[model samples]
Target: MMLNPAQARARLRKLIRGEERVFLFLDYDGTLVPLAATPGEARPSGPLLDLLARLCTCPGLRVAVVSGRGIADLEKLLPVRGLYLAGVHGLVIRYPDGEEVWREDRAGDAKKRVEELARKLEPLLEGKKGFLLENKSAALALHYRLASPREAVEVVRRICEEARPLLREAGFVLRTGKKVVEFCPARANKGEGVDFLLSGWRGAFPVYLGDDETDEDAFRAVAEKGAGVLVSGRPRETAARYRLAGPGDVALFLAEVLQDRSPDG
Candidate 1:
């Protein structure tokens, strides 16, 4: 059953109270920053960043921003010291204590392949107005949020007809998200990142918030061991145990948690 925003806030607080160590794994774009038609348009507000800063300071809490963005991009938005940042769908990770790692594919060919496609996509989509190509190391996203509905459909069809089959044959997969189509290598997903974060932690429950198909990986990971929350317009067969209507609700819910915290020293 889906929880209303108020109920979700209460539940999150209860979860926080139970855990000795609370790890917050959040998706960047939709979860933290408002989704913008252009990638560069998305940025978190000062109060929001301050709230995250405070959350990171919670004595027994461990927090991380696990995002689909490149590590460099995530860093630009959040300069919080000592917060673990995972990017490229968990294929790239930066630890809180000053360490970084990349998990490459078996043949070590994944990065080069994704990059090549990213370059090709720009030229392929050059004349198509209102479309964007977001090139992540492990994947590529084609955003059509600004396109007219008819144009978006045509563009997506062309992409599916041309790109999806090629990526699939190459052992990559295609996913459709909110006005966007994404292609990712099959080996890694966000779930792997969640597990990576919990590797040595003793009995820590997980809470992952995301608003897209890419996030299903993290949700699946949490559902398998702890819990998952889906931020969607309406529920489907997603791995989430709870749901919130939109980004505003997510912010309010997050703010509610911060307000309820016993004031820090």
Candidate 2:
């Protein structure tokens, strides 16, 4: 069963009260803001920015945005300082102090292979209305959220048929999310990213909030030591122990976290 807002708040407060440090990991697109038809349309609002800034300032709390977007794109979308960013599903991690780390992949030609895949897929999707080919440097995503249902089905079929062999040869993986399919390096995933971040702060209480299939790895990563809050309105099989209705509820819960004034707060 999912915890309601009040229950979630009380539970979190108790956890925060016990921990010496708290680490909050957030997924960008669906968790922090509503999912947009296009990636560019999902820019953060001023209030959300303010809320994040306040959370960063909260004592004994650490904040990071772990996203499928590249670090450069995340930097543009979320300009809040003092916030760590893990992009390309944690292939790249940037610290609040501007230090950055790139996870080494076994495939030395991964970038070249990714570029070639993009080149091959672009033409396939170009004329298909509402199909967007988004190249995020380290990964390529085919967005069909704006396409008609029939068109979406056809596009996904074509992609899987055409791209699967190449992906297998290049050591890449395909991930499906809400109305989109992503071709990314096989070694890069949100779980490794969450584990990487958690490694830096020993004994910290960690809480992650996300709303997609891609986030399942992260949910499992923190399952033993922390809480994974799934943000969705509908019921589904998930590893997450808690759930919030939507981004609006997420903001309210975050506000409660910021307002808590216990000794560790």
Candidate 3:
């Protein structure tokens, strides 16, 4: 059962009411900001940053931007203080206190393999317009959002076929999103990242918001401890306990939270 806007807002308010500790795990693209034709065009509004900063300042509340983007990229884009940044699907986590943690020590080899796969896929998608090969250093994403449906499907099939052997040898896994396919390290996922971020905060509740299939793992992770808000215009098979229409709705929800000055209410 997906929650409507009013119901979802009321439910979220109740979830955080009088809570001593809260953790917010938010996805960047498509959740905080609308999905852009190119990744570079996706940018959060200035007010959004101010709101997030205010949220971070609230007592006993910790906020984290957990996205598939690289840590450096996220740092450059969202310069909010007093927040955590978990990048590369949680492969790397940077704490607000200047501490950092990484999942594996063999990232060098993994990234090389990912680049190799990208190279192999380039020729396969040679003439396809709007086919973007994004290398996040820790993962590779094939974005065909602007391509025609037929071309997207064909590109995906050919990439899957050509990269199978490389993926096998590197023990990598493929994750599908809205018109995008990602090759990531098998051991690192959004779920594991959420767990890592929540470790030792046994009593604290979590609220996760995401908009893509890649976020399903984080949704399931938060489901055990708190709630997951799926930001989509339509209902779909999801582990999220609630749903919002889109980024506009998400901003409104955050604004409500910001207006609630009392943290222990």
Candidate 4:
């Protein structure tokens, strides 16, 4: 059974209340904002931005947005202050201190292989409505959200078959989420992002919240260090110990967290 927001909040607060500081890591799409038919259309709303700004102001609270989107795109979409942003599944990290780190290894042979895959996939997806190919400098996402179920299945199968050899040779991994299949460097994952965000921090309680399969790695990472909250509409097998129905519940939970640190609480 999934824990409701209140139960999840109580448990999380219990686990972290003793810690000197807290590290809050979040996934972008489907977690902060509802998924959209096109990636370009999933923009952060005013309320989410305001909530994030409020969270950042909390004393001893560190916030990081860990996402599969490229760092540049995340910066453009969010434009919030005092928050770390990890993009391209942690291949790129922009710290709150204004320092930026990128896995340049992906820029060498891995990038070549990804480009080769893009050339191969682009031709196949042409003329197919609802099949969008997004080339996020660090990763490639094949979004079939608008494609019919049959088309999506066929395209996914073909890409998996065609890219399998290239990915194997280049040490790349294919990750699936919602209606998208993303090809990224094998070394890049959300777990690494969480590690990067918490590096050098002492005795900090880490909390990870996400709503995608890609988030499982992060769930396991924080489960070892602290906790993971799964945001979903239905129960599923996940490493996350707690759940919130969707982004609405996530907002309410964040509001509660903010309220707890307020003067009245």
lDDT, candidate 2, residue 114? 80
Q: What is candidate 3's lDDT per residue for 1-265, written digit by digit as tens?
A: 6779778988897778767888889999999999998888999889999889889898778889999888888988889999899998999888988687788678888889888888888888777898899998888998887898887787789888888889989989998887788888886689889998899476889999999988999999989779999999988999999998899999888877766644543
Task: Report the backbone clash tally of model 2.
Answer: 0
Q: Write the per-residue lDDT of candidate 4 for residues 56-150, one digit (tens) a residue.
A: 88887888899999888999988788988999888888987778887655576666777888998888877788988887777889989899999
lDDT (Cα, tens digit) per residue for candidate 1, span 23-44: 7788888777778887788888
Badly placed stretches (over 4 Å) of model 1 are 106-108, 233-237, 259-265
Work out the TM-score per prediction.
0.88, 0.94, 0.94, 0.94
How badly does each model clash, as a count of residue pairs? 0, 0, 1, 0
lDDT of each: 0.76, 0.86, 0.87, 0.85
- Candidate 2 — what's its lDDT? 0.86
Off by over 4 Å in 4: 104-108, 262-265
Error of 1 at 21 (Å): 1.4
**C-alpha-based local distance difference test score of model 3:** 0.87
Error of 3 at 150 (Å): 1.6
CA deviation > 4 Å runs, candidate 2: 106-108, 261-265
